[model samples]
Target: MTDTSPASALDQDPPRRGWPKVDKVWLALLAALLALAVLDRAQLGPSLLFTAQALWDILPFLVASVLIAAWTKATGLDRHVSRVTAGNPARAIGLAALFGALSPFCSCGVVPIIAALLAAGVPLAPVMAFWLASPLMDPQMFLLMLSTFGWPLTLAKTGAAIGLGLLGGAVTQGLVRRDLLGEVLRPGVAPTCCAAKRSLKPEPVAWRFWQAPQRRATFRASGLETGHFLLKWLALAFLVESLMLAWLPAESIGAWLGADAWWAVPLAALAGIPAYLNGYAAVPTVAGLIELGMTPAAGLAFMLAGGVTSIPAAMAVFALVRRRVFALYVGLGLGGALLASLGYLLWAGGGSAG
Candidate 1:
């Protein structure tokens, strides 16, 4: 016979007692700073400044995007995702690809928005399309690329962004159709903030969420949780990015990618997996590489590859999905980048040679 009393249950499952622990992300940030101080004291100040500046620059987008996700959850706007998912699959995928390419959200900033969508039962295909493209190109990036490179390269990158989104969406759709993509979200990840407590059926929208006490509470809790989650990861990501910039010179990237051999294009894409700084920072680097004899096609490959798989972007994706889904995300990014590069090469009439 089992002892089923409350006392027995309490004894069996004791509550933990201690001060709240710091998350690994915060510890990682601290560790990076300490290592910089010990090894290269001169870079310590610069690195700190760089992380601070980058965080500051992104804070507005972070706040706005987080609030949007929270609002959607609190007011039941997520029902609209069901409507979208119910539409024609091909049309939804195409629209999502185009919209993601034009959306202002950065790679990391779009995480919370997509989390809400997925948790609310949005189909994986269109979400994957947006996930692939949102990090690659935006209006600001397009203009910046135009100024740094010529119009041809800028247009090529924009095209790559949309094309990659389409390819990723189509692949994800096939996998989902075959019932291969099981349980995309990692267990217990963003359960509260992203509204992972999903309903079995769509709920009606309550546009004025503030009118109800429960809805107001949900809004506050969701926003706070999402904000905290984003801050820690982005802080660590920016710190790592700062370290990468300080250690890896643009000239080395140029040298590795400057070769005229056919292999250099794919090599550039692979190198970009780790070597990329960010879209804004990459423009001048690629331009310098071109001046240093890197072909236009290779530069395009490097930028397209890095745009999707940068450390910050990849980190965001890893935090949201299970390992298998994350693997797919990376594979799509690398493969799509290569294909886009080849297409641009063919269309540009031998690219640099022409």
Candidate 2:
């Protein structure tokens, strides 16, 4: 028979302690990337040189990411984000999407914010609105895409991110009204992670660049942490990009996914569900695909789908929310990706498919 008393539980065991700070999954990922590098090398010397070049190309973005993270935290814009989303339903949803587009945080990084909002009694719909749009684009991503895909496609992609936010919010509003949110938040419970540790109290944002010693410390910590988080994954992404550019033959993407295939857009969207690529890394790879005959529509679809639902981001959501909410999140990501792809096809017309 098992002991069932509270005193028995105390005598039975104490909670395990001294957990490692580093995530094992991340270590495993690094190992996998290293293995790929070794297995796929065309020649040891050439591959090392190419990898160095790829790392150099991505270094600037890493610096920018760190700066942005620290600056955003210092300005306390996130407190405003919380305030906006907790307002009137219609207005809240619109503003949430708009704010989300401009947010500097990545999909996984934003998880803490989303969790905090729920803990503070923010509505599921507007928070969900922000959640759906936040990962797809940031200012850094926008400029990069503009330089790579040109003004037309880049603008359309940005528009699509906002549109998805609006659509997701409205749909979620309907669900909210009917009390059909499917346990997006557990009553009076906060997610157990970085979010649980941070104080979510609303504080006045200091406009001065270096308002206080503590603020400076916060900015430095946030920047360092954000930079460290981004660099490792980005390096892995660039490595994959280099490998694809080298090993993937011309016409491979276009051979099956060209504009001629009526089903290609939707299929590409589906493929992006399980495919993992960081937003920054996806740009060069997508350009390479275009050069190699991948339909522009297909590449864009992959970017949309994969950006919103990358493996790490999706896993973070799953860890925080209930199974039903996770399913809804995935559903929205796929639907949003398809909608954007179809919109692009109409806008770009026949010229993009070749």
Candidate 3:
């Protein structure tokens, strides 16, 4: 008989070599751009200072994410949330929207959780709702806005987020096909080995000397993970802030999205599609627009559309779900943004009339 042992397979040559013949020229291009960015500015001292300041500003959000993740893991909250989501689609959407409204997560930061939820058989509607709601509706952002922009803008933004989230959920449920969901429509099974290992592990003895070291080690590991996850985003936020501060022609942008135009809201929403800034970074930009005579309604619309709708998020959903369903999801976000913008305009107008 022919030998087909695992050892024989290990000894065989790989099918392809030299980085699998894939092109990584884009990586080189990015490296070149980074080199230019560093060299373009002579004040390395100031650059380092700015980077530190940016990191300090973002630290609270990063800390909050770590704490939330740890809490969820420790209290088995993730499991409970999974169970709720798996129980019923309608209830799942409500829970997800509420959770999204309350959680302190950026749109991009929430992607992994959303992916896990979808993988765990959470309905597409609720998953979509969470994705739309988490960035703008979170308590931190809401509270920050309340202080910075006052109660009116804060209330308007929060209402828009919740309304749009619910609308998006309904639209997604109405449009998506059951069969296209395939295996993703069912609840995920926990790994048997993980539970078994946890059961088998012995409880540690209470020793102060060892406890301090262990705690320190745990914190250090957590800090490293949080830094790794957030550093790039923090840098990107700084770059956007810098661009808005220095190069963007505010007068031109304002003229294009002027208050008198009927197309202003939709135009602003469409213009925001290419923008990658999250709510924290976007708040300052929107404030700048308001300073430039952009109406509060238009600014709110821009923030909503820009914060929730992103090319990357759309691409991730497309990769995971059916093409038709992906299209529906995109439509929900874009359409919901437009509808919310219109709703804001009508509500504001009605208030003025009254």
Which candidate wins on lDDT?
A: 1
Q: Compared with the true structure, what per-residue lDDT tens digits does model 3 show for residues 87-194?
A: 566776777677787877765556545544543335677888787888777887887787777777778878777777787776677655444433332111221233
Give the per-residue lDDT of model 1 (tens digit) for 49-161: 98789779888877876787678767777646666586798888898899999987766667766776675557889998998888789999998988777688888889999
Report per-prediction Cα RMSD to one decimal.
Answer: 5.4, 8.5, 8.8
TM-score of 1: 0.87
Ranking by lDDT: 1, 2, 3
Q: What is the TM-score of each candidate against the true structure?
A: 0.87, 0.61, 0.62
The predicted structure with the larger TM-score, 2 or 3, is: 3
Which candidate ranks first by TM-score, i.e. highest?
A: 1
Candidates' C-alpha lDDT = 0.77, 0.66, 0.57
Q: Clash pairs of candidate 3? A: none
In candidate 2, what are the lDDT values of residues 1-354, reduced to their tens digit? 111112233445566689657855468556755776678545444645655775565455456645654655555544455455555899989988998888866665566566545544467888888998888888999999988988877887789889889998898888778877655753213322233224266457676748676667656766665555444544444444345445553234434565457788887786665555657877887777676666677777887887777655676576557777787888888898898888888778624432
- Choose 2 or 3, whichever is better by lDDT: 2
Query: How should the candidates be ordered by TM-score, best one leading?
Result: 1, 3, 2
Cα-lDDT of candidate 2: 0.66
Off by over 4 Å in 3: 1-84, 177-255, 311-326, 350-354
What TM-score does candidate 3 reach? 0.62
